[model samples]
Target: MTGLHERHLAVSPDWLALYYRHPLELTHGEGRHVWDADGNRYLDFFGGILTTMTAHALPEVTKAVSEQAGRIIHSSTLYLNRPMVELAERVAALSGIPDARVFFTTSGTEANDTALLLATAHRGSNQILAMRNSYHGRSFSAVSITGNRSWSTTSLSPLQTLYVHGGVRTRGPYAELSDERFIKACVADLEDLLGHTRGVAALIAEPVQGVGGFTAPPDGLYAAFREVLDRHGILWISDEVQTGWGRTGDHFWGWQAHASSGPPDILTFAKGIGNGMSIGGVVARADVMNCLDANSISTFGGSPVTMAAGLANLSYLLEHDLQGNARRVGGLLIERLRAVGAGSPAVREVRGRGLMIGIELVRPGTDEADPDRAAAVLEAARAGGLLIGKGGGHNTSVLRIAPPLSLTVAEAEEGAEILGQALHTAT
Candidate 1:
């Protein structure tokens, strides 16, 4: 192992995983590419797990952070902060929730924690409904609602969380059903689940399950669930940490795909709003937000530097119409990857929307997941000067591809070619 790797292993927690067998230290990044400490450049397909929304080293966000830091990095939440208020106003306006109130946090975990606090307090219930194979975050409360066994570290939790169906479209009891029927079955299952329970605080779900290997149900499944939830007066919390801010392409927010049910009662977002800056927040209806009895404040949330980065990053994203770019480029990339997967026996599925795509690997002619083959492909891709990510509810057998929203068509094609070669050689 490299000296740096040895040192990292010595200092970092064993549970904290690294990518390649011989981890490459990335020295710097520009646009869609990054260079290793060896000065070898590789195309970045994962975008730091979808946190680099616009691009690497985006000038606008860097300048904003630099300028803001020159003035004031933070002043705590006790005083009136202009950048925080400005960012909150922008987010609240963009969030479809009527009379929305935005509360900033440092990470998606904290954001979801706040959401749970709001829902439980507002409804006077500690019960929450989460989707199977769903991953929200890593905190105690976040893990409580996370249904992914690989991610949940402990069984002990503060809230009663019940796992539900339909987060994953395939490998489930309803996978064989048609989209319409799938929605119907999921709704029926939800209704049945709720019939046996009472005083549920909320139903939290990701429109596209990110760490669950980008699996998702039919577009309107959540809308159908909304009908059942409304009957119980259960608030819906959309965990948009991975699917928010136009990452899904067709819609500004993933929840919009289920617009027939109107906006979610609460929406939490992180990853990508500030590009690489640490920024997370929850947007809820005014009543739900104000429902908290005691005053709550985030000391480092919405700090001047991060808020400035968020504002500039958001502005650049909107101005450049990166959403449209993601749609066009992502469409080309998925089709190219589907073509690549067509001849590979190891590939069981290639599915996603926008820049968020996943290629599920399986044993040849078998339904069983091939996590070993997936890891091999990841290493081979890196050796071939392409970087990608892997995730799955079933042993991390899925190749996750979430490039920057500003990816060019040429970059997508290049990435596909490299990925094809990696799959061919490795699997």
Candidate 2:
């Protein structure tokens, strides 16, 4: 039989990243644990890059998908769809925008693309402002705005993007400032840039900068920017693909931490709403959402199957108060991981909130990032029966941990124990 590795190499793109020196094929999962093709059980820390919002193979989501499939899987957006309407209503209510309208897509990339279109069209400008370490998605427009060179594949883009400061709090020019000073400095920088630029459609940002190693600005940085943008009649678009649906613990949406006047003009989300089904969407105010004049349709955007799955998954999350669960469990997990990293010289910083956490690895006793050491820790953790992820703009030297919202205390301890061992051995 052909090996999985050989088969993938023959078909998958070379840029497709895989974890570990020897990747394990996960066959199944339950709660926070997953089993490999060889039946080896391991604690899943990353949750498919935070896609599994609830738990693996969650019964509620599964039942909803099957039941919907039994009835009828899909009908184009041109027709009235009950499940889509229900999911849309729920998302709009949670979006924190008044008179919000929701538009579903097949993936986060599409959701972001739709948002960019709306912002540029509504503001009548093709110019966008993006953060230095922010990542929106992988589509052409998304990549064009992505600040990480490793993720941005080309210089060709339909929109002209201007880079901004203060996405990554530490290791930047203003890293040494107090939190209050940092916010003030970033706001001043944005104001300065706006004065020099023209046709600035909006400032698009990731509240947590997911692929940029989960880094975020001070709590109210965006709030200050909101004030400046409002003066210039610019829009704000929060790319919440990794920070939405209560993943951040303290707030339902990541922007809530930075909210001053109101919610963003547009919000894009994906990765967890369907709990595994491919469902992405954008929520915006009525005026902004209705800015487009031409007719539009999405054949697979909110197909009954995925919408049913999303409705069920969201219901389960709210009913169980998983947001509260993420707050409590993620708080404990962060403290545990911080304790584990306390003595490790290679561990530069441990940061993040809720279930989304990042451990930046650097040379022992120095500030230089150590990608090699980070990779070694990842593989060592796998050997120790715990699977994690690595990412960063600094040569990809950050260890990312974003388990499902339902992560239990016991699993957190177990994963921390193994991770501690892995860090010690690898360092």
Candidate 3:
């Protein structure tokens, strides 16, 4: 097959530059690997921003999508579909919420928008509280709550106060706060913000900050926040767009990491739910979802094909015990990475749970700045047949290694070896 780079060079339009993409064009993918248009193979540790938890081109998902496409692709929301109902039931059952009701959307952004709307509707309030360095989505309402200004340019109106504190950083005004102090401060901030504002509607946050460099906050953070929200009569929204569906190894739902506390009033999930089929959902408490009228609908949210794909994906995950694999393999990978970092001056920190891992790189000086050597390390890794991602505020120089759950031990070791080689080469 001809490479997309070659074809683009010959005939592609100039508008393609609007988006930043890898120079290589992928032609196909299977399991934990992808082939460039030129047939060069590369191990995919990135996993489409951690969306392909079960891996690319899964057999069962492909068969389900094909069969459903043959039967029916889409229908108006005014009509009911068997596949949609079945998928919803399975999701509710797996999520441990027997009376859960689902509202589907085509992407995580839409799912977030739906969740925010539902929360505001239930409380009839406009004020929302969110954590700093947290990412919900890119839509108008979702972006309004996002703490990153790079992703959003529109000036936030007075109605929204995107809280910007209590994340993983050693410097700044928040540096004085320890993990426990930070959690307490977050709760205090929410309470103070809600004091003057009557009828504060909801508070939304990611269980583990993803785009903010996979930072996991202190333990009991969720429970403390949940308590504050309950006291103020506000809904707690869990944005599981990246952490949901077994990527976090220890639990099926990333929020389960905080099971000692209480569950969120509303949960939004996407990324891996449809195994790359572009499906997302808002799973809310039965009472909260009941406020929506029967007339509320999405034209293509729960189409038969996407529903079938979702069912097949979930079934495969359960049958193969991919979540167990994620936990075991991810633990092994983290141990090895930590060992590698033990003696390396360039590595500032290693953090993550399950398959979601990040390695923070720091310079040799006392400035505590991101080491450009880490960027060179990633370039070297790509040249050495491995692909990784960089993230965090300074682009904090993290090597994001979130491979498919189906990735084998041998493949994981090989990728790590290449990363080691890349690190040495860059140094």
User: Which residue ranges in model 3 land beyond 4 Å of their true spot?
Assistant: 1-22, 157-159, 169-178, 367-374
TM-score result, candidate 1: 0.99
Cα lDDT of model 2 by residue, 1-427, tens digit: 3399878888999999878767778899998889999989988998888998999999989999999999998888989999999999999999989999999999999999999999999999999999997788889999999999778899999999999998999979899999999989998999899989987999999999898999999899999999999999999999999999999899989999987757999999999898889999999999999999998999999999999999999999999988898899889999999999997988889999999999999999899989999999999999999988888999889999999999999998898899999999998
Ranking of candidates on lDDT, top first: 1, 2, 3
Can you give the lDDT of residue 84 in candidate 3? Answer: 87
C-alpha RMSD between model 3 and the true structure: 2.9
Candidates sorted on TM-score, descending:
1, 2, 3
Against the reference, the lDDT scores of all candidates come to 0.94, 0.92, 0.79
Question: In model 1, which runs have C-alpha deviations exceeding 4 angstroms?
Answer: none
Model 1 sits at a Cα RMSD from the real structure of 0.7
Regarding lDDT, does 1 or 3 come out ahead? Answer: 1
Model 1 Cα shift for residue 333 (angstroms): 0.4
Among these predicted structures, which one has the highest TM-score?
1
Q: Determine which window of 10 residues in candidate 3 has minimal summed lDDT.
A: 13-22
Steric overlap count per candidate: 0, 0, 0
